[model samples]
Target: MRVVSLVPSLTEAVAATAPGLLVGATAWCTHPAGLDAVRIGGTKNPDVPAITALAPDLVIANEEENREPDLTALRAAGIEVLVTEVRTLEQAFSELERVLVHACGLDRPRWLDEAGTAWWDLPAPPEASRAVVPIWRRPWMVLGRDTFAGDVLSRLGVENLYAGHADRYPRVPVDDLCAAAPDLVVLPDEPYVFTADDGPEAFPGLPSALVSGRHLTWYGPSLAEAPAVLGAALRAARP
Candidate 1:
């Protein structure tokens, strides 16, 4: 079955499972390096006409990374679109299974099984740390309530300062974020690229952990390495 994926994580998942099945993907879908799929466009503004031209049997998308109007447009073009909403680790696994077994009609990838075992078998950290995780700068956007990344951090015993906020991704002042008295500040390198030298200075007295955005944010094969990858980074941000 021919497939086109709009989400980078999903693209990687599908490509890893069966590279030949992926005929097209978004320009942002850069994973499993040297992927030979046709570039459709960005997640927010995919080239629907170009995608429809591919005549894929299935198109994979994510609720958070993609817009509804685009998905509707794809459906309007008579393309079978599979939209996934993954807000938690469990949901991520379940959705991926659905996409692979149900949508693409392929055998489950071994990496996915390893990922589930890695996450579920992890022993919770004994000490919890309070932190401010900033996704973007300039205007400053933070992870808020009910977000997948927030849930992942919670599992590692790190409390996000704005997790109780009404907005899923809240734009807040950097000064106020510091004033919250979080023991540490966590920064990821995607959506906004925060490096070790660049991000640490903003926190002043607070220790900052510059983490891998792919591992912390994306759900796919990376989920298997997240427990160890994020754990080491968060471990350095202690009081």
Candidate 2:
């Protein structure tokens, strides 16, 4: 079946489930390397004409990734749009399974359930008591309560320093970060690629680690591999 993916995360999911089935994708969908697919456009502004030209049997999008206007336009064109809103890790897994079911006509729940169980079985990472996870730079955005990345850090025994803050991706002041004085600071590699050099200068007194952004933040089938990978990374970084 011909499929078009407007969301980057869902593009990764589709490639994982049915690699060659993705006929079209957004320019940002670069997860599964070697996917020579058509770039229809971005999440917010998809090339409607290019997508229509592809004549895909299905188009996948995410509520957070694609704007309502874009979805409305696609729907108005009578395109079968599968919109998913993935917040928590469980929701991400569910969305991935749903995509697989729709794209490949496969029973994805069985495999997803098994993977979920395995993820739950892994031992919890050491609790750092207080921690801050930075997913973006420039303006400096952080994960807040109820977010999948926040939930993942919680599972690792790291309490979000800004969990009770009003915003999900709050712009924290450098002084505020210093005041929080977290035991650990997590620097994700995507959205913002923070290196060891970026750490010492920005956070002079904190112990920081550059982590795999996808493993810690991307809440899809990747979660199965994340718990172990993240747990090990955090453990190794501990003082």
TM-score for each model: 0.98, 0.91
Residue by residue across 1-239, what tens digits does model 2's lDDT show? 88899877777776776677889999888788878799998878889989988888889888777888877877788888888877776787777877888555865744466668867786755655588888777777787767778877788777889888898889987767878888878888877888877754787767776788888767555767787788777776666
Per residue, candidate 1 scores C-alpha lDDT tens digits across 1-239 of 99999999999898889999999998888788999999999999999999999999999999999999999999999999999998999999999999999888888889999999999998967577888899988888899999899889989988898999999999989899999999888899987999987777877898888889999889988899999999998887676
Give the range of the ten consecutive residues with the poorest summed lDDT in model 1.
124-133
156: Cα error in model 2, Å: 1.4
In terms of lDDT, the best-performing candidate is 1
RMSD of 1: 0.9
Q: What is the lDDT of residue 143 in candidate 2?
A: 79
Q: In angstroms, how far off is 77's CA in candidate 2?
A: 1.0
- lDDT of candidate 1 vs native? 0.91
